[model samples]
Target: MLRSGISIISVACLLLFAPIAPSLAAIAPPLNLAHSPITQLSVPMALFSFSGSRPNYLGIEDGKLSPCPGTPNCVSSQSDDAEHGIAPLKYNNSPEQAIAELKQIIGNMKGTEIISDRADYLYVEFTSSLMGFVDDVEFYINPEQNVVEVRSASRLGESDMGVNRKRVEAIRAELNKLEAQEAQA
Candidate 1:
């Protein structure tokens, strides 16, 4: 009885797929290389996009950038845990001047979009060059702390390969360089 039941299922499957086989096979014609120097096609630089939706918990909540989410793909100066803790940026200038310098530095980065820019708060999106994955980075100049609180989090994925941390460091380096240039000038 079991053998007959199995056979019945097998036959049913074959009958269901048999008529569609020819149509599937005819979906594409055989490749033709008869013409030499075939036309070239252009595709966007970042072919695959994985940018997740923007989070609502961005910007300052209580005189600070949002705490890093419970994931390895995030880093925040406001976070206390070692896994997510990063020092806030210190500047010896007015908050407006600090924000202006930050805007210039971040605007020049590739695949970046400045979503929101204010005197003391900025929300920027940084997209990866290859897979087009986006990371949301925020900076809030807390006059009370006299430092810029930062939060960088990947929109999608559990592991960003330390990208968020490295980006913060790079921005810190850039800020330092810019400060030095201004000091000299």
Candidate 2:
């Protein structure tokens, strides 16, 4: 009971403070000491951090992304079920250009680290700003379908509050906007 209670409190604190950490730091004026508490809380953050080990089944297998493990914390373009399925990213230009633009879009996002960048495949790790939760996101340029197949999944937990799905959609929106601008140029 005590462990569970602590877990709940930790999650609550993380959720409450994560979004406002930067603001707190800035609130302290020129020195920006808002991050002082963050440093102190690092121990708690590390303790509660549920970042699981990276999955070995990450890359394309047999022409498709690995299926989501019947979990809501994941979304994939190749998923057959609607709950986990998302439309693959479409591209008008060549696959090379498409992936390049994707890298550009993702590179600018907060707390993202590109893990792999091959000619036809890309893998990235995204960390939450406050709680340090990690999510793996992958993209494969499918020339056969003229789309970029994608998979995004949390490293731990069964729910991500639709974050995985929203991220893909957000990236889709950015890609669309970038392509539109490229067309104009």
Candidate 1, residues 36-131: lDDT per residue as tens digits?
454354445453578878888787766867777788999999899999999998888899988998998898888889999888899999998656
RMSD of candidate 1 to the true fold? 13.4
lDDT of 1: 0.85
Please report the candidate that would top TM-score against the real structure.
Answer: 2
Q: Count of backbone clashes for each model?
A: 0, 1
Query: Which runs in model 2 stand beyond 4 Å of their true positions?
Result: 1-48
lDDT per residue for candidate 2 within 95-170, as digits (tens), equals 9999999999998898789999999999999988655799999999999989999999999989999999999999
What is the TM-score (0 to 1) of candidate 1? Answer: 0.75
The CA lDDT of each predicted structure is: 0.85, 0.88
TM-score of every candidate relative to the true structure:
0.75, 0.78
In the order shown, the candidates' Cα RMSDs to the true structure are: 13.4, 5.0
Query: 156 in model 2: Cα distance from truth in Å?
Result: 0.4
